[model samples]
Target: MARVERDPTGDVCPAFEQPEFQAVRDSMKPNPPGEPRSEEEVLRMLRDSWKAGHDKRVEDWNMQVQRDREERERLEREQEQQDEEQAERPEGEGQKIEEDNGKKTKKVYFDENIAVGDTITDRPASYTLNKLKLIEYIELFYFTPDGCRKAQKESRSTASTETWGITQMEGEVVGLQPISALKLSKFVKPDTELSWEEVMLGRHAMIQEMMKLGDEVWPVKVVEAFNTMYAALDAHPMRRQEHGSEATVKYQAHVRREWYDRQARKQGFNIGVINETLLRSMRDEIIDKKKTESLREVSVQGFQKNLYSFRLPNPYPSILSE
Candidate 1:
């Protein structure tokens, strides 16, 4: 008997008309009505989604690392050129100084720590105290070697030429007001004599009082007493540690991201939202509670994402409807 091929025009395609086709297709389709997904199936879907996100994050991190590597190389080349130029330059040609009656006073630039007994002979200074009353907490903002190069690269891309050709200056220093002095002012009454011993002993009491009072309200007398006591403390040689143009700033083992937020508040700025990389870095940082408490601001949420999810529309709507 001679074999005959199936007709081209048929109710269903030959491929779809096979007995095994429907079973294979149905198996690949989503769970049917009245049927719930198994735990294994749900877990599989979740794992797939997580894997997709993980892969994306890893890709981003790798790209960033590559960019960082390139930036470092560029910076190293620039630094070598700068060192050569520096060597050729005259000793004091570009030196900046302050002259008082023909006597050169040492100028302590940024990142240099200023402690008590460090006299500022410069007339018409911004601060009231000619000599530092307290060392306080030195807020140091730093960029790592890689971070500095990255920042420079970004600056260049943004048309900022100020940081151009700069390589070695990795950080800045900000001297904040003394927390102890601020607390001591709280305990001061108009007629109450300020004792150093009491100031040390009542440190805890001062904290309690601050918490109880809520917002700080410094009276005129209290302010005057604070200034007096602060000045007196500075004058006392016994209380003075190593002073002058010394880099005495030592940061805690691990700093909290909230510390920057608190500083931002003091400086009158908002932290707003940060990127995933920064958010992860912040979480890893562990700050001392004592430092946070001294900062005097309640913790606020950091690096929170506001997100929503929805299913994508099917592309073949006409076919699906049919």
Candidate 2:
């Protein structure tokens, strides 16, 4: 008899249709509730699921940390080996050294500890003294002289003729009247006499004081003088005709244009017409003539579609709705 042949599709394997396999497949299907699970059971399931996920994440992170640590250690070992090799090499072989008289003379090094006096020969003592004198003069002018004047009648004594003489001379030198001198004399302490050195130093001090006063007051004087000169020029019979003259007008215009151009160049701006254009733009901005859309409107428009669920309402509902 011929051997019976089994049809592969028609015949099912016993293992494939086993109860264990069927149970596993049924378990994979979502739970169908008869009644909702107890709160304890639901909480226990959630905790188990979370613990499993956390364990898997921790394992992955640990593997990554191990790999990074090994790589870092390998690089550190390589660097250490390189450093050791470099240290073993002879200095003369590694670096070029200049020989002077068959001996190495190291280059001179300077630091803050190296005295300035050591480097500088023949420094003038008088130079330092002069600097000190200048500082003293400024201090006296701002602090001492001002204090003395402010003290007025409170600072007088009879013993020191020198102090009285100096005060009298100071008043006279500065063109104060006799009554003003007497009033000032009440401010001077008679016993508060300066030494001979201080007296001699006073001349230089006075000169420096004058210079400081001149510098401080010169700008105001210049501005006043310029205003007076401008007024005088305006009043002069020649000025109107001169201003009307094409050549004179052209010269003044050219000077002003050149000055503006020079200023623009100094400030790293483009000169000529570009500077004028920029200045005009700046002036328009300062005058509040320029208009721009509200920042809130611009921002809202930019992100209008991208926003998940946000909405903007009219701030003034009547105006916007209308």
Candidate 3:
């Protein structure tokens, strides 16, 4: 066996000291049966195994990071392709145009035949015609003094009188007289056959045209009522004032203004000063109240008159001359 030696530190070196060698020899000797490893050896083996496990975990983590990077690159390429495809598409295709704010704009289609300045007309008949006729007659009756008093008395029992201010017959008459000449023409002859449907259709068309005219012309319905009332009053004679007296005319004007104010209230309109020139321009068109003519013509005339009369600081003389 190799001789063991003592070092200056006062500890025996295993290679040189006999006692230390003997201890090593004893430790290496085989046991009678199986035995566990020495503490130092077991600790060394555990440290080596832990180092191997640590290296494997680092490799797995690097592999996962690489896979994620590859997936991210693939997604980026796909997104780029989709963007290019969308950009290549034409407008108004299956894909709609979107505003920057992401709202889709609607496509509007216009009818080829519809043009500006076209006129439409209509007529009326039967129960509908009868009802309108009755209202018109009542309006006419309310224009006379006796009619006005009767209307006021009747109004207490009827909603129509209240709505129309027909109770004050003289007042209604004075107010509505300027436009009283307006009338709806007859739809049928004394013994002639006629279709109610045709009459109704005509009436519907007339109403639509009137509505389209809006405030430009007095409502056709009101005009009809005024005419009807006047006719009724004409059938029954009432006390008459001197035809051209200043007082009588002045009173008529005042009543007319009052009636107009009342009408404005009923129609939920602002009571503005009536433009005299515009009223004169519309006079002929409205006065006739022919169902055959388009309300648009009357409206255009009225609008031009009002515009020239009220809005323009100095309208061209030609407009007034026309």
lDDT winner among the candidates?
3
Which of 2 and 3 is the better model by TM-score? 3
Candidate 3 — which residues are off by over 4 angstroms?
1-33, 92-322
The better-scoring model by TM-score among 1 and 3 is 1
lDDT of 1 by residue, 1-322 (tens): 2222332222222343356555644454468675766545655555566567666555666666677799999999999997787677788543432234367669977655855566422121111111112212221111122222333344345443322221121136344432221222211221122233333333222222323333343234433443343333334443333321011111111122343345446642222222235423333332344457655543332212222344578999999999
lDDT of each: 0.36, 0.39, 0.40
Q: Compared to the true structure, candidate 3 yields what TM-score?
A: 0.20
lDDT score at residue 166, model 2, on the 0-100 scale: 23
Q: 146-221, model 2: which lDDT tens digit per residue? A: 3334433232332243232122223245323223223333233221133222322332333433344455432344
Write one digit per residue (lDDT tens) for candidate 3, span 217-314.
Answer: 54655545534332332332221322212222222233334565565466432223333343343333333544335577888899999988885455
Which residues of candidate 2, in runs, are more than 4 Å off?
A: 1-35, 92-322
Q: What is the lDDT of residue 94 in candidate 2?
A: 38
* Candidate 1 lDDT score relative to the true structure: 0.36
Q: To one decimal, what is the Cα RMSD in angstroms of model 2 from the true structure? A: 34.7
What local lDDT does model 2 show for residue 2?
29
- For all predictions, the C-alpha RMSD in Å is 36.0, 34.7, 34.2
